[model samples]
Target chain A: MLPLPVLEKAQTELVNYADSGMSVMELSHRSGLFTDIITGAEQLLRDLMNIPDNYKVLFVQGGASQQFAMVPLNLLSNSKKADYVNTGSWSKKAIKEAKKYGEVRVIASSEDKNFSYIPEVTSSMIDPEADYVHITTNNTIEGTAFQNIPDTGGVPLVADMSSNILSEEIDVSKFGLIYAGAQKNIGPAGLTVVIIREDLIGHAPESCPTMLDYKTHSESGSLYNTPPTYGIYMAKLVFEWLKELGGLKEMEKINRKKAELLYGFLGQSAMFQSPVQEDSRSIMNIPFVSPSAELDAAFVKEAKEAGLETLKGHRSVGGMRASIYNAMPVEGVEALVEFMKHFEEKHAQ
Target chain B: MLPLPVLEKAQTELVNYADSGMSVMELSHRSGLFTDIITGAEQLLRDLMNIPDNYKVLFVQGGASQQFAMVPLNLLSNSKKADYVNTGSWSKKAIKEAKKYGEVRVIASSEDKNFSYIPEVTSSMIDPEADYVHITTNNTIEGTAFQNIPDTGGVPLVADMSSNILSEEIDVSKFGLIYAGAQKNIGPAGLTVVIIREDLIGHAPESCPTMLDYKTHSESGSLYNTPPTYGIYMAKLVFEWLKELGGLKEMEKINRKKAELLYGFLGQSAMFQSPVQEDSRSIMNIPFVSPSAELDAAFVKEAKEAGLETLKGHRSVGGMRASIYNAMPVEGVEALVEFMKHFEEKHAQ
Candidate 1:
């Protein structure tokens, strides 16, 4: 969700950012304005996440899916074997890409439970020789999240936080790298935010393509080539807005309230059931299924009519999924909960 | 240059694009609306370029620079050798990347003339056994353009049209593949348009990164992952505007007029000189140096004060440059020509 304030700011400055007569789109990325934009976004994100000075934030393209490939390209070359925790479809996709580059071990998987829970990770499952242990912080389709980041011992932990980043407080030092596609919780699509420890870069074998090399982007400070200027500018605005809203601690407080509002309603609903296991349920994505497919269809249609849109679950796991990102206002979720109650009463068993 | 009409359309539809109640930025790339957007953009670009049925237009990210690496990673792995024609800085960059993947033969070069001219190419200059031949359709920094497409004699020819696509009419059927970063003639940065022949979609070497594989993008319709949604949407609008104003034939006519306006003035100027050879001069990027470096700096300063922006020439070759892309209006060139005349008269030694 692009917050209303973010939209207003972008709208007011669509033609020109700050005092520059050119739109952010027209500014040469080498220009000082753009340098400030990309750097400001990084600094804001760093402050918000409490990222360590050792980490470098690189703005890139090709989305999270590309990172699924890039992570392997840059990191896996150092240790061909990397431990992967398969929680959902995103995990499977990442593993498939990594296998092409090096050895990827599925150390633990919740696929047996239809990915409705996060699998328990133990030190035995982690290969000390492995370069990194990969995890999807939140599963958007299956409505699951890592309630606690697994202890990787000394192994570098990497995560795809595309679905839940910026919605809660996280220890930046806990993970060696964290990448998120910017469509959710951040700004727009097309921009991928990669926060990597400086030590992990430059290990890719000579066969790795230059663009996929983290070293290229890191050395140039994410300005190796022309970046998605407009997206980065929007992200900077979103970060500014996030900072103004009292950082992630405050963001988490509101997010938990909003998530609990809908989840609490689901807990009492007679006609709806959330598929996620209680301990691993995602606060960011709440997926529920009605007693009948016909009822679920009707509820989705009615919810759209009531201005609650994009409630349809991912096709891979069909039902209803409400993504309540940081930008989703409490009023929106409360309204959704109210609507769900009305629908439940009308179709109660 | 983002045309005022494009900006106006984007501004008016910034928050709710076509009554969807969501900004294009927030739209799910997999949603029907976004499908229409990405596909509509491809279709419009296909229409504009008269792309043949045998060709596929893939809207991938990472810009033309990424393509510089991707083209070699995917295509050159077959023969492990490719012929590259060096026209300017962009060509040199592409060759540098291609070398990392496989052997690149400099078939012909104009560096002897300080990249001020496009070298003539004959079929003999191409390595027929080479996987492909590479060229830059237009050099953005050095202000040189290939007035004629080289005859590769059945060798697949890949061209980077980042600075000149849509500004002119060309035979799309002639090249094996063409890619452009969207910042110039398309819409914005970060969106790379890759139009390739169906036959060249697959067959990357085993070591190729998944994201760098053209097949990954082509097979998924450039939707295998979240794409640069907003950039594609804006490109759609720009395409619509272009179609409304009579497509590429008309775009070419106006662009030629704009080019001639400035070039004609440069031709008559005594103190101002274009370093490019006449036959190889770029209609898109017009670079001219004054009699002295101080004079060139003064002109750029005065031009910016007069509302003309980003006229500084690339530092590799210091002077002043006016990038009059397809979005640049004839009046923009007229004003620049007028300013140059006034500056020349004032600084005449």
Candidate 2:
């Protein structure tokens, strides 16, 4: 679980934000209190990512789902064809939304393999004249992740790291744009964090709505319209918490340990089988299935009674999923492992 | 000075929303906790608006600013020109944003009269071929309001009622669409409420972003993306409070009394001058200026010492403004009157 101190501080301020005598939710967007929260949240985000001066960090609404449409609208300039590598549900959704705006070329997809592994995309698969290349760095639903980013050559590289952001270290300068919906590893869901290169602004088609325009939101400091104030505020706290824990390097080590422990238990157990290939298994979401769907339901039901909530996998893929996000304590995982072992043994017959 | 009960309730839940055991800001959009919130908020809005069976209410992210663009994208179908009556800052912004999508004809404007009154429009000024006629029922920044809605003559009439929504009574069926940002009267900013007639849906341009497409959001019950959960929750409370106060008709009577008291003071005071023409003055925002900007600033500074906050006029107009929203009690208006009378007596010379 997340630290008590951070949650307590957030709780204290939730009722009254930064001495404004109003909850963060009640503060007016144009008020000085909200200005501090917005500026502080942006600054903290920039610091967390060591974001360069050339890249702009925008805190927008609609999570990464909306960005699926915005990315093509803003970046698919000079060419109608954009390349997308679909690893899971989110990536596929992104590609689907992009189709409405432009021609989306699926350079690679793991759907044929039930999204168990990230497909290898060759340079030949990508159109040389494509406007940009998009990829999902982490497949939250499928429990897979990209071990290596594809080579886009000269095209701008865009990645959605919603499920694994702040859980590990990464080279921020490599991608032209990176967006994460703050739910699993960040703070919440409504506040979407977009790290876009400065030059990508103002390229939206003439018919693009003002709110969906990157240039408009970026120019207004993500306050062009009223932002999700409390979500950003909590995200700022999460960033501060990450910094206190020695940034992403420490986080990466802890995450590796947690994943290793949980995956080790799954691999050694004969009662369960993982959905994703071992090499491509996600460090955040671990989806596993039993010999039958009935057994999977039993596993999830027993786990919830044992205090492991939300263990049920997505309805599309009926199974069990253990989401060990940044807030999921190592002890919590250990407890989950102990429970999983007991449950497997009890149901072995 | 909104009521303290709802704020207190919201303050308590700000830390943990509806027994989800986490702050509303921390819940995932896909999580059941948030799904219930987003859905419940929409249902609450539908109930409050007494929305007809044919109308759809969408909970969108960006404030009315986004609707400015989306309205034209969705409703300006098969027509080259749209009619707009420029009543205040909001309608002007809507007209400006709409120009990018379609031709706009300003049927009437009060700018020549310093925006102190809503101009009387003649049917001759309206283009019958226009796809939709848009107006801002209440202008927050200018303290001007449409005393009477012009006849759209069977054409769709849309309104941006950002500042004055839920403060009075109106027949929802008369308009094709009504949108409001929740900050002023409804609750807070970030959550925009859009009520659209059924026929207005499904006309968005092919290039419109999914998030800005009214039909897309309407179909998903605003769960197409992660909506601002806390904002919607607080807005739900505000709607409940409105219902408790006996709905909009009762609210309109109380609102009229508050406006009359405040306007009566402004009309009689020798040391102050109101910007709006007497007949067209806003019941919500009352903007007044002293002999000079310096005097206005002093008046504001002194008024704040007496616990009268946010009385400074909007930056566009340099003076003093008292926003007596639905939440503002009659006692607060009396207190403001007392302070204004005291300031006038001391500074009249």
Candidate 3:
């Protein structure tokens, strides 16, 4: 969901951006105004995340899935191998994409348990010669998140935190790169936020497509080609919004409070069940199931009628998921809980 | 620039899109509402372009530059060569990208003339063994356009119509594929509109990155992953607007009128020089230069103050370019011509 104020701001500036007499969408990517938006986005992200001066923050397109291919194309060439922790479907897809370019070792997997929890990853599991150890920090489909980042020894840790990037603080220096598809906690899709260390920028192979080469984008400051201009403008606003609200730490507080209210109700409710383990449950994506498939369907339908939306779980999970991202208010979570209680009282089996 | 109607439509629907109670940006690409948006966009484009039922309209991201790599990665693998007609910077970039994947025969080039004209591309100029013949239909910077599509015999004619697509009528069935970056006449940046024949769909090499593979995206209906949701939605609106405005032929009429108004003035002006040959001049982007460099600078600055924006010529061209695409109204052109007349009267000496 869009932040209301941001949408209003964009609406007011839809036709004319800062007296340029054109929407941000209409500005050339090479224009001074557009360059400022992109660079300002990077700087805001850096300020909020405490990203080191050495890290190159790229505003890219094609989402995290493209990054799945780009990461291997750019980095996995040197080592010809990478360790992948299969905690969920997103990681599995990343592993599958990485295999097209290099050898991907499954160092750890919670797939055996239907990806209901995060896998226990250790340095022993990592290949020392591996270029990077990859992980999906948050699983939107499976409703799991790594509470803390894994120790990859000297190997770089690459995380696809598509659903959880701005919800909490992360040490940017710890990972070689962190990529997030900007639809969840960020502003929109089409914009992929990639924060990669300087050392990780320039090792792409000859076969690497220029667009896939991190160095090309990093060197050009993500202006190598026409980027998602309006999306980047929205992202800049979201970044500024985060900063205005006292950054990620403050966001984490609100997120935790929101998640706790819903999770607390789910834990105590007799009719509902939280499928994820306590430590692995995502504050951003909360998936729960009713006692029966029919009830789960009914609950999803009824919730939508009552104006709580996108509550149906992913087809793979087959239940319900309340993806309470940064934009989801505590009141929204409370409303969901109240609806769950109302349904439970009426349809107590 | 974004069309006023499209931007206003997007603004009205910015927070809640068509009673879905969510921004188009928030909708899952897999959801029915978004499926309708993408498919609706395709159908509208198909209708507007009179595209054959055999063609697949894929809404993609990373702009036309991504297509530069993707085209060769998918098409140039087996034949190992593609004939490239270099008209301008965009085509040169495409040639550079295709070289990474296969041999690119420079069948013809207008680079000797600083890309002021489109080279004569005859059927004999195309290598029979070539995978495809690549041409940039419109040169945005050089202000040149192909008045007629080149015949490629049995070979596929691949054209990059980034600056011209949807602004005028073209026979879609005459080419194997046409890809356009949407920032020009289509909608906004980040969305690429690819209209490819069904026969041209699935021949990517084994080494192709999944994101770069046309087959992956085509088979999945451009939702192989999260697409540029809002951009596609905006494109859909633009397409609908085009359709509502009597489609491309009608757009051509307006575009032609606008271009004529500006070019007609420039042609007769004693102080200004039209750098391009009249036959090769683009109705979409028209570049003109004044008597001196200082006057050109003054004109651009004064034009900006007069609300004529982005009129500065590409540095390579070193003049003024008034890109009068479909979205540029005739009044805008009239205003520009009046300003030019006023400026001329002041500095005619």
Predicted model with the maximum DockQ: 3
How well is each residue in B191-290 modelled by candidate 2, as lDDT tens digits?
A: 7889899998998777777777888888887777667766777777777788888888888999999999988887888988898888898999999999
Weakest lDDT window of 10 consecutive positions for candidate 3 chain A: A2-11
Reproduced native contacts, each prediction: 0.74, 0.50, 0.82
How many clashing residue pairs appear in each of the predictions shown?
A: 0, 3, 0
After TM-score superposition, what is the CA distance of residue B284 in candidate 3 from its true location, in Å? 0.6
The predicted structure with the larger lDDT, 1 or 3, is 1
Give lDDT tens digits, candidate 1, residues B1-349.
7888988889889988879888889888878898898888889999999999999999889988899889988887577899999988889889998888789899899999899999999998887799999999899999999999988989999999999999989999999999999999899898999889999878886666678889988889988888888999989989998999899999999999998998888898898889999999899999998888888889989998988888999999899999999888998888888888888887776
Residue B29 in model 2: shift from native, Å? 4.5
- TM-score (second chain) of model 2: 0.95
Per-model TM values vs. the true structure: 0.98, 0.95, 0.98
> What lDDT score goes with residue A175 in model 3?
93
Each model's lDDT comes to 0.90, 0.82, 0.88
Deviation in Å, model 3, residue B166 alpha carbon:
1.2
lDDT of 3 at A166: 90
After superposing candidate 2 on the true structure, give the runs of residues whose Cα lies further than 4 Å from its correct spot. A1-4, A122-125, B1-3, B15-20, B26-39, B122-124
Over 4 Å off in model 1, which ranges?
Answer: none
Q: What is the TM-score of chain B alone in each candidate?
A: 0.98, 0.95, 0.98
A1-349: candidate 1 lDDT, tens digit per residue? 7998999889889886787867888888999988888888989999999999999999999888889889988887666889999999999999998888788899999999899999899887899999899999999889999999889999999999999999899998999999999999999988999999999999988766678899999999998899999999999999999999999999999999999998888898788889999999998999999988899899999999988899998888989999999889999998998899898888776
